[model samples]
Each structure stands twice: as structure tokens, then as C-alpha cells.
Target: MSWHSDDGSGTTADRTVEVWPDDDRLAEELGDALRDAELAERVAAAGRAALAAHRREAAERDDLALELFLLTLVHDSELAGGPVGVRDRSGSTSRTLVFEGDGVGVEVELQDGQVEGQLVPAQAGRVTVRRPDGDVAVVDTDEVGWFHLDARPHGPVRLVCESTRGTCVTEWLSW
Candidate 1:
């Protein structure tokens, strides 16, 4: 199910709740499985991944924003369908990617081996930039929702944001 929320910013945001299939057997099996601590941990991780995938799909379709956790894909980029970032004498390139998830949005710019950006609606939060290998950097956004990270390594990357506005994860993008 889905509901609306206001974070004292006077803006209403939509949130989605967990939903389970209408199958007693499956529920019973999951209940039994949870009894095993190790198994339960694995199951939880798998479930989170699955939920992320679902959110990514919904975000790609321009679905409503989720208050608890929002996973979104890149919505637009002037540099879309372009070649690798070109570094000039300054040894940095500039490309802005915009991602939208309901009431929240993140705009990231990569340049000079650093990732800098701002969050729409401007709230304090944390930004984690991760690659398949692991998280490359985690930084806190100022009260105005601006964050910066240096020493970025190029590869496939995804961004996760957490704040009073809630959590949001962006789809994997080449960096």
C-alpha cells in the first residue's frame, strides 16, 4: 500500500509499504526459514536487493516517490548517449546527471576525480557512492543538501542518499 507524508517542509511525499503475496504456504515457508539466523540474514539481503530492483523498475517508469526508500534511475542528462568524459588540461570533465524519485531529486556532477552534487528540496543528509567492488566514498551533505567526494575511481557506480527526506538509491551508471 502507499500513503503520503510531510517532513515539515510543507511538501507531501508518497511512501510505499511492504507487500507480500497472497500465499499462505509461501508465508509459512518464509517464517520457518527465518528461524535460521544465518539463513535469515541471507534472505534479508536478498529481499533488499529484490526490493531495490523493483524500485528501480518503478522509478524508470516514473512511478511515485517512496518515503522510506526511493531507488531511481537516471531521468535525464544533456550528456546522455555521449562518449567517456573528456578531460581537458584541467584534468577534469563535467557532466551532470539528474535523478528523480517522487518528491526527492539528486543532481550529480563528476569532475576532476571528484563527485559533487546537490539534492533538490535542500535537506541535510548523507551520500554514499559505491561501486561493485565496494563503497568508494561516503560524505555528509550540508544543511542545504550539497556534498562532495574526491579520489573517485572510474567504473560502474550507484549513489545512495539518506536524510530527513528518507533514503534514495540511484541506478548503476558508468563513471
Candidate 2:
């Protein structure tokens, strides 16, 4: 049988089962399982909160040492045939950005909705690409410090390279 609460809460079942006629072992087990589930939920919530806080703190600190400096736009296929100061985006051309920091040089190429890049001074390490919407792609560099990503992101994006020398983060760029 089921009964509905007058306060519009919900319906409750008043059926009785004899699964544990000897004692309340079934109820105890259920209680333990529920407690474990609740604890897990709380831990997950705490972790989410901590991550949000960290993102906020990172957003506020713009002068981090690991933050890489924007050197210059070394090359742009769009401007290959045009004047140096001319701006054009009507053609299907890739863009290349060069960033230098901590004696390391990174070349990023944005082409056909894919990101491919290389690092100078050949070193083995990991490269993390982060988008403005918090989406991330992590890839390990080869022994020659080269990495590629099949996935592309919209809006502004940044890169953080971790190598034996140190960690360097690139400034956000939109292409």
C-alpha cells in the first residue's frame, strides 16, 4: 500500500518484508551503505569546492613566475604574400605563434581546427593546453620536444609546458 503526504512532499510505501526476520541485519547493512554513499558525496563536494577556489585564485594572480611571456608572432600564413602590416583573414591559412621563456622556445600552430606544436632545445616533458572554458588537453612530448593535439578549442587558449628545466605557461591567445 502507498500513502500520499498532504503537504505535497511525496508518497510513501507501507509494505513490510521479512527478509531479516531474525534481527535488523538488513536495516543495518542498508544504513552502513547509505552512510558510505553520503560520505563519498561530501568528499566529492569538497573536492569541487577546492578546485573552484583554486581557479579563482589563479585568475587573480597575473604575475606568476611560471607564466610565460609572449615573444612575438613569428609567422602567419595569411600574411605570407601580403605586406607586413596588412591584416587579412579571408583565406584558409594557419597561424603560428612563437613564445619564449626560461630558455625554452615554443612554436604553436593553429591549423584546420587542430593544434600542432614543437618546442626547441629538445627535451622530454608534458604539455598541457587549456581553453578559456576550462577544457584541457594534456600530451607528452617526444624525446625531441614535439607534441600534437587532434582536438581543437574555441575562444582563447593557453599552454603550460613542464620539462626537466622547469614549468612555463603561455599567455592566452585567440586565433
Candidate 3:
């Protein structure tokens, strides 16, 4: 016998099958095929939904359109004015960056694989630390706008702060 089946593209294709009236196995095989087809359609629908969700997130990230500014790096000794000359050291030295905007200011200190930072005009908010490879670590700031992250992110990194002043995204930096 010949029948038509949907190929999932709003089009039908002819399928030829042989039916044996006395063979009970044919009936079982047909039932199994129908079940498998239904399962495949469900799986495809799920995959489509996941893809749509991912696209929406990407769009939101792009829509924020936060400005990126360079942060000036300063060493502890420089701030203290102990010595003006450069010195060669074996180990790493502590570094600090101060980012000042119109109404927002952020201070970050990096030492010993730990990040300690404070935000000016202190308000409660969440801070997100993002790596270049899309890895993110988040922390909530206290009422005083203090936050800490015990992670060492290699390569370029950036920060995103969501506070009463709205969202602020920092320029990529390297430690």
C-alpha cells in the first residue's frame, strides 16, 4: 500500500509499505516507528526553544551599550611616593586601578589571586566579573558598596555592576 507522510517541512512525500494481514509482527513494528517519530519531533522542538533563549540573552547583552574606558594602573609604592625609580622583582607586586566616571567611581585591588574592590556613591548592587572566555563570577555588594571575589582570572577581564545608578560595564583589563 502507498501513503503520504509529512517530512516536517509542510510538504508530504509518498511512502510505500507492504502490509501482511496475518503477520502480527507488522503491527508491532509500525507502532514502534510511530512512537519513535513522535519522540524525534518533541526533541527537535526542545532544541529550538533552547536556541531561541540563547539568542535573546545575547541580544540583551548587546543592547546595554555601556561605555568602555581605560583604567589607570598604579602600584602601592607609587602611591606612597617611597621611590620614583623602577626595580626588578622576582614575584608579582600588588596592583590597583581607579576608574572614575561622571557619577560613578570604582576602585579595584588585585593581590594574591584575590580581588577586593569598592564602589563610590555606595549603593546596594551586584557585581559580575567576566573573563574573556565567557566565564563569570558574581558577588553582591554590601550597603557600603564593598565586594570581593576569591578568584584569579587569567587574560583579559571586565566588570559589570548593577546598582541604583543603573548598569555599568568596565573596560577589559589584564592583571
lDDT of 1 at 162: 86
Q: lDDT for model 2, on a 0 to 1 scale?
A: 0.73
User: What lDDT does each candidate get?
Assistant: 0.81, 0.73, 0.74
Model 3, residue 22: C-alpha shift (Å)? 49
Model 2 TM: 0.52
Model 3 regions lying over 4 Å from their true place? 1-62, 66-92
Candidate 2 per-residue lDDT, tens place, 17-123, comes to: 45665457878877787679778799789999999999988876754634544434455554566653333385655666777764777887777777788876788
What are the per-residue Cα lDDT tens digits for candidate 1 across 77-153? 44567666656587766767888887888888777678889988798999999899888889999999999999567
Q: lDDT for model 3, on a 0 to 1 scale?
A: 0.74
What ranking emerges by lDDT with the best candidate at the front?
1, 3, 2
lDDT of 3 by residue, 1-175 (tens): 9999998999999999877766688888777875897787997899999999999998877765554333333333346665543343745566666766667867887777888888777888888888877856899999988999998688898887777877776777776
User: Is 2 or 3 the stronger prediction by lDDT?
Assistant: 3
Off by over 4 Å in 1: 1-68, 74-78, 81-92
In candidate 2, list every pair of residues with a backbone clash. Answer: none
Pairs clashing within candidate 1: none
